[model samples]
Target: MLRSFSYVTDHTGFCGTIKNSASDFVVTEIEVPEHLLRDTRAESLQKTSEAQLEPSSLCLQQPKKQRTEPPSPCAEGCHGGAPSPSERDPSCAGGDCSASPNKKQPEGEPELRSGLEEASMLDSLLGKPMSELLNKFACDLKDAWDLENNADAATREFSLGPILDKKDRADLHSAVRQKFPFLVTVTKDNEMIVKGNADYRELCQLVTEKETSDFFKFLDAKIENSTFSFAPDGNKEHRKVVHHFINRKFGRLLETKSFTVTDVNDQPNMSIMVRFREKSWSRKRSAGGFQEKQDLYTDFSYTGIKDKKAITYQPMVVKKVTPERLKEIGSKMEKKGMRIHNIHSACQHLRLGQLKGNHFDIVVRDLKHHSHDSSADLKERISEAMENVETKGFVNYYGPQRFGQGQNVQTDQIGLALLNEKMVKAVKLFFTPEDTDDPVNNAKRYFLQTEDAKGTLVMLPEFKVREKMLLRALNRYGVNHEGCTKGWLNIPHSMRIFYIHAYCSKIWNEAASYRLKIYGSKVVEGDLVFSEENDESVSLNDKVHVVTAPEESANKYSIKQVVLPMVGHSIKYPSNKVGQWYHERLSKDELQMCKFRVSPLQLNIPGCYRPILKNVQNLSYFLEGSEKGIEIEDNHLNAPKVSLHVSFDLDPSCYATVCLREIMKCDF
Candidate 1:
């Protein structure tokens, strides 16, 4: 193969230098294609005698003339073995290549070369090119480096090969191991000690297309008393062990440095507050299939929407230490799996589950943008609605999200299927994975549908970790629907929790529906009432808590609390007709109130009560210019628009949507 490089005598021009100085020569990889450096090898080497290739005869002991220019006047007489002017061959013309025969008449004392000069001479001798003198020297310095004969030692280096998928971008991961061809040892010796892929050089090269050398500077990491602190980027997640994207240059220092975590608590909190205040650039589709430009701000507000107003945020207070390492930008596309999950966990948080519910501030803005009703009309409507709400109270409806929020919603159905031990249905529902973009997964799902557990397992990419796990259970026992059903146990505990929670939510919603239907808007006797004033000892398992008339004020009809049942093994139906109705419903399905005791899975969902009534406090709203907040810009309406600026506090787990439905009288 041909290489594009000149044999220049003076090579002092190389701005690009790899951070790793392990080897004297940095091999900027030449694209030696498969045709060039394949596993195919030449015939066995013809062994040579020790006389033909002596240790001193190799490139290490090449003539000084071959390594550098002839010595200067200060270097004169330094090479004692060098022939004098009188003894020098006549071909040594007087160009300082050799001194004239009798010209040096000075009686100076013996001089020795400085250490710097000696080292320079050695470097030049070892690394520089040699002029060919084939007459005496049998071979060039490059030719003597044959691994078959004179080569002695080997060195291996690690590098991130070109990664295509961002999610599978972690170095040394199983995917990386399987995909990238691991590079090992360059032949410097004949001893042929075969070291593995893990035996790698400590340092790496980082090159950028831009002029700024900012990335070249290593991170300023300080670990005092086991607390590691380093500046994390706004784009990347904070990392543990200081590896991955933050320049692995300091990785070796982690071993020698005093930051070795001895105790579990000493593990550093790598959680970084995601920069949600800033805008993220995204390519959005506009007209046709073309992608349009858009600056999407991070949704930091707790309202769970992508509107501009939601961009205002504070750092999320994380309770758990971040266990994920920062993904190296450009290493790979992080579009799926644990990498994306971790990124989402570290950055975009999903406001779900049982929120710590003392109080939650709800900001309902721009209601007027969508509301065409007049101010007085809206005010009268809201007043009447609130009065009605004060009397009847809000329905305890678990919004569309509980069932997976979109048109073909079915997660709740899947949850019920699992709860009922309809494992096949649950597996089928789950295997038809959401966000179907990858064809490979689609194919695997097809095989899974065919009940070819083994085939599907093989076809499923390693990245389809969840699917592989379920299929592995099937494979381990035997390929059958029953074994596959048993594989549901292998699914994530969080997922199992979700299924049970969804089932509980569904049951609760139905019971609430029945309650609403029977007693339309009145606090009846034997009804469980949730009251902040009622200092009652309520177990989370207590599905329904009965209450007597309050002594604070006998005639007061305010709904301080409206509690409903959550199905559990230890729970009981409410008293009177409501309790009878719950009994009838549970009896039909052969489901006991105590059937929710999923103790074996440790998902023992102790029933809890959700308030059937929630009071909105500090409620206020205004038309466009009438108030401070009126968010018209985000409302997509021009000026003179009516934008409701409302703020109120509701306990955690209460949906703002339900309250909005009462006020706006519209389904969003």
Candidate 2:
């Protein structure tokens, strides 16, 4: 349990549990579009698929020899041959007179009297609107197949105008598939296309050459569009097999979209599209002023997919980092169930505080309220509490994740030691193991007892990389004050900064609570308020002016306008009682209010200010409608129920857990 953070509202918060499961807490960074990293897998997969199925056969295969004679009307049921005019019967309707074709007729259907009669018959089977649509499509199909008028007849393609209704288009597509076996249908942007076997066979040839062209294909001819489209003819399972086969062979180069196609025998099929993604490049001027291709693909790569569990993503800008180094970093992160995706070159590096904020989806379970209350009563209470939070907002305290969790030494403890210039104590605090009797801890205990860095290194688990690094440093430098300080320096700058930041956060939290308790919601004298230039979106920097005294009262600063500093040498404390409180807290820690630097450590704490109260953005909640309990680990109850799902957005660095704490009034 953590310390009780003060709340702004007077509403009584209900008791509930959070994060019983990983899914209970969901967080996503709200990044800017310009800085959004691309996912290289999508492009890489496409290229691989295309490379595997490069359309070599399509280019190599001889063009079909021009047919000398006209194609037979047998496909249109003219098996007996064209009848003489004198002998032609109106009932024949340009089809066979002597016998019915091998094709299955619609049940209880008679021979067509004419094209109109056939359409009329279809009008009864499907709706009139659909019948008319198919009628037009049939005409287009006939025109494309007409070899007499069009020289490039086989290459011709036409769309069966927009079929907006999915069911209607599907039914019509199915009908056409059965009616015209040689023709193919592909729906794009609600418009259906009718093509011939010539195109399909060319694609099949490419697929046959590259057995596993999964997502993309390369073509010999220059394609103006990025994607190459195809339709696979089969039942659902057969289509699935074809799709899986292509994916396995091509390895994700092909981009696929679902479209319905029916086989000649009226079985359903899958529609597939392949997008060929090449590295985008720019034209650069050489010394001669002539344009040359400059490869920009090497500059930018993408990482991450739309995964709920893996919600937080950040873009990193590295200079002079080799592929091998990137691979090593990726491998290490992956070992910890994390990943670094798509390392590519970029024109510029990402800057900190460039994002708007964070989005959170939180679930609170196992509600405990007044015992006799009904479900509706409980819901009302929950809603009321949430309403207060939405309207009045909660105190903006940093969550426990900022500090170290469990029984291990809190990050602030080490930070305090560093602030007090007790470098040896800080170093010891870092290596000190908890009371828990775990194998990893036992290894740490062994190191403490024997002082054999090499032997302990062997016993240390592979996952404890930081500990291993420290031990290795000690092995080289020996275990002494100077050696340990050097070992601490070996740790990453970001991590070392984190420990100090945690201490600052601790002070910020305590100061904020006291401020709220003494002043309530009123804006008082000596309170630091942001100038107009400094808003929630802006980062705390020298540019942001801290308005105090005359300006604070004149500006009518609200509680939300008040700011607290994260104690640093550069940052100014609040001028009133809250400011005095910071001095007292630092005194208790055996540190001066002014000096925050250790010259030898080569570290400086350039702190920033944060708003004491934050208004929850787009706050909303709903009751989970389930009688069954959510299965959770380490639950003593027969069935621990999850009742509420809450969602909101907060400014960057503001903790969702703290907001929930204000709502639930329960320590996590």
Candidate 3:
């Protein structure tokens, strides 16, 4: 007999079997329990199938015979066999089914997996998908901490735009708080809680999208204008307080203030007023005194007046009397021999004395009457005698006298009359020599010196009858020539004699009798004249040529040869020819004398030997021979004396010629 075996199936679809070796029998058709099969298939297909099955439908379809009894094993006999359908546990039937086997983890496994899944879901939702929550949390935590840390920090609403999602608002809030810690605030009622005073509130009202972008601009302008003052003893803390106060209270007002605070000379507690006013003040003060001051006027005076009655007379010498007091002295003189003819003469001779000082012989003429000496007869006699005469008369002889309107005796007026008859006698005796009977004899006796007289007198005779008679006599026989002739001489002899007389008379009358003394050489007719005016002891030896030329001609020819006149040992020439010789032939002294003798005629004469002539010619040989005399040898011509020709050529060449040698040797 075959040995028998048995097997059992679990809900997971895994089966267990037992076998005996002696029997050699096997349970070959072992099936899993239906409930276990259904459960396992459902778990296996869980990834694909999700719909649930009903358990009632599966139970209703079971066979009647199968339901009556469970099937048993045959005689071959396996004692434990696969359970029949009816014998399988109904708990495993399918509907929603047993939990999927793969999903049916062990006790703590499901809880642990659920816990990890929850944690992962939360991390995804909060970190990536809902990052706004994370940002909000972070911002809230920072804000709370700041509030707790700083007393000045307060919670307030801050507005983010409506376009800003939760995440953007959270991010912006965080950024704002980080950047401006004191200004950061949370939103309350959709508006930001900006921490500021009334001015800041006003600024907040002004904020827009563009204004927010430039929010720091106003702050910068305020900071620029704000001024902080510190006390002398103030420390840094005091300065900081002052700075804060200034930055807050007047932070916005400072932007509009005209003045600012600056340290002047290292002192910080000062304010500068930018707007100033101009005014003027006096620089001088009035004088002060105790007594009342007098009224000031331009014409004010101080000295008082005195009474006019106090005046007293001081006597002065109004007039003085002299020992020679002669009154009506002019009339006394007039009674003696003088009388006036006119008012002018009377005024001229008023109150004058005669005495020893002056004498008078006066005549007055009555021009209206011509009878010879009645009252006018005596006047005519005196007038004829006094004609053409200068008579002495007084003219306010005591200083100057004045007699006119408002004229007082400011000047002395002692009148004087005088008689001077000498001028009248001189006039009466005046007559030319021609008026005499013998004019030549008269001129000789009166006007001409006796021993030196040579010419006849030629008087200026009048054209009267007596002068005509004398003239006719002179025409017959010429008068002795001595003086000037008067009137016309019609006769030729008389005229000729008059001219000669006039000529000689001029010479004798004006010139001295002695001769003019001559010092130098004298020449007459190309020969040296021995002058009687010079010393007779001197002699001349050397020969000289007298050079003369016509005044209008251009050529000079030697006129004659004469001994050179010498004064002492020196030769002399005429002053007209002083410059007309070569330098070699004459010493400077002799040349000077010759130069003095050079006249303009000689200078103009061509071919004449002059010092300047050497400049125009090559006469060096002549100059040398003349200097050394004719005895000099010809051999000496080649000596250094010949070099003088070179010097003379060079001197004139400066003005005339160019040196070819020098030109050829020139570098340029």
Candidate 4:
């Protein structure tokens, strides 16, 4: 049986039956009392009369004349035409009112209106049919509703003065206008005020990320009742909503905790251990769509999501770090080469009173020699190579992670566009449609590429939040690069940096390969060598040393490690045979070292030496399982039959695939 809920309010003398729709929370079927419906028509008409009489009188004066027939129905939870009493909210409007300008008034009556600051709403487009108007405002309506009811962010105590900067304030104002195209005006007086055609409280909470304390009790009560009483088989999805809010609240509290568990992918990631602090809040990875990470924690370790696929974090240990000095977090003064990106990617963490030293392991599989190779034969070959690998070492080639997956090379194209300062091309590609299965989203992307922002805005489905944001930008500002810059920049700072880094990775990989080729005469005068940097590495090189002669150069006998710069303005090119390659690459691309600048100061990957080779550690393989007739990537896996599990550990900044390639000699 489908679970349903009925609410009766003694306050409004209103009663109705509500059931959860398949779409969740939305009222699919609402049955209001017949008398209540009669009241709504009367009230809506009455408000139309009074709005013209006086704007100030809305809260203060009585109606000019009293009706002899009956009380007018309230327009409280008003959404669309002839709202049922159950949907009407008394707090919004009572008796009679026209919240929108498009609502036609009776003959010979001046227009009556309520201001936006008092309610959360969006305007219906004037002179358009109901169907067209609804389609145009579909996606934006969802955003307004989310802001108005997101109880966690809506605390009575929240305000704009404490959190937003001048730039943030301006951006928010633009966002409000963009969200509701018919929004009359946004004034700068007391924080951001969206004047017409909007829900006042919803817009306030949306921008300020706070809500009144009055709703806290109601929110808490609902969560507790729904969560504790939840049944897996219940038709109502209220329990899922409770869990979502709980997880969201928990993620916020993690900022104060010593350690936070983050969902990496298939397994628990390196973020298992971290020193949480306020400064770390600025990291791009820290915040997400559901909640701001800097938010306060009401729950610490609530693991209600039981399924393995659903839970992102696993239990891990964390310890408090006692700083010897006033350490600045989210600043560029960290011990050299300690960029935030590498820190998270390499899984750097504090251990044994110091920060990060040899503390990670990687497990790789699928190492068959050829198409028909048996599991046992592959394991024997891998075992033999492990011995030789321990002695020689694998080249530190920039693995597939550097290039991105498959033939798309989208990142490479984005990087090239960024390097050339082609902002339009870069952002256009980002919002453009690929061979995606989502036809609705793909159609919207096509509209954007064609510069039909208005068409795309209406065409978009409600869930395309990101695309809607892009279309709104193009709508407000023209559909051009100059107008679209603001929206283009809104694509998270980390994402933009990643594109540029892809280009740099390509250069680094080529240079590493070049260095290895010239190893016969390794370490000539003016040659740079690896700084013997380890996982505990942080900060930039304060001193510069150059090799003047082969004898003065230091090496670990046959180990022979060399360092290559990652193509930047501050790069140190080799003066020997390898130096020409760097100069040629830079000249061909018309890129100079001084051009590598980005926001937040830390993403600037300055000159540094990365070792050319790395040896796999604890390398071993084993046979396991079998495949009947499964297919992978359109290729049959029956021949390989799931065997040869390889386990090993590599230092930070090394790809496990490189070690595997040396052993198996096959593209993976």
Task: Give per-residue CA lDDT, model 2, range 1-668, as digits (tens).
Answer: 24765788866666677776767777766664641322101111011000111110011123233222222222223222233444433332222232222222232122111221223223322333343455455455445444346656566566655654454455445444433333456778977776654433333443431211111112211122333333343345545665565455433233445565444445554445444334211322221111234232223222211223334555655533444466778877788766777654332233334345678887778776634433434555677889989998888887887676674888898888877767668877877788978877888788778777888789888989888887887888877877777666666544565677678888888998999889888888777775544222233344335555776568666887788887776567777898899889889888865466554453456555778888888998876534655442332222346467899987655678788888766677
lDDT of 1 by residue, 439-526 (tens): 5556555665687778777676787777778777766765445675657666655466676667667667677767766764455666
Query: Which candidate, 1 or 3, would have the higher TM-score against the true structure?
Result: 1
Tens-place lDDT digits, model 4, residues 1-668 = 00111111111111111111222111111122323322111110001100111111111112222222221121111112223334333222222211221122232111122212111111111101221233234334334344545643322221122112343343333323333332323334433333333333332332111111111211211111111111111212432443344345433322211122222122221111111234434433321111123432222121011111111222211112112111334255345422222111100111111111021222233334454444434434545666666666676666665665443435766776676766667667656565566766566466755878778778778777666776677778876666566555555443555677677777777766666555543456655654433221122232224555654455522324355666654546667667788888777777744456432212243434565566666666554445545333322233434444445655434555555556554444
Query: Model 3: per-residue lDDT, tens digit, 1-668?
Result: 00111001111110111111212111111122322322211111001000111011000111111111121111011111122334322321110011211121132222222222222222221221122333343345334433435544333333332321343334334333322322333455533333322232233232221122123222221111122211122234433443454355443233222222322234333221111011101111111101122232222111111112122111111011111222335577467553322211000000001010111111111122222323423223223322211121000000011111122211111000000112212111221233345754364334323312122224433433433443444445443321112111222322222222222122211111111112121223333222222221121112234444342143332111122221111233433332222222234223323322111111100011111101112211111322345433433232222211111121210111111111111110
Task: Kindly indicate the candidate among 1 and 2 with the higher lDDT.
Answer: 2
How far is each candidate from the true structure, as Cα RMSD in Å? 31.1, 24.1, 78.2, 27.7
The runs of at least 3 residues in candidate 1 whose Cα sits more than 4 Å from the true structure, single-residue gaps closed, are 1-393, 407-409, 432-445, 454-468, 478-482, 530-558, 592-594, 599-602, 623-648
Q: CA lDDT of each candidate? A: 0.36, 0.55, 0.22, 0.38
lDDT of residue 662 for candidate 4: 61
Off by over 4 Å in 2: 35-352, 370-376, 534-555, 627-642
For all predicted structures, in order, the TM-scores are 0.42, 0.53, 0.10, 0.43
Cα lDDT for residue 623, candidate 1? 36
Q: What is the lDDT of residue 504 in candidate 2?
A: 81
- Which of the numbered candidates is closest to the native, going by highest lDDT? 2
Once fitted onto the true fold, the runs of candidate 4 whose alpha carbons sit more than 4 angstroms away are 1-380, 454-471, 520-525, 532-539, 552-560, 598-607, 625-639
Q: Pick the candidate with the highest TM-score.
A: 2
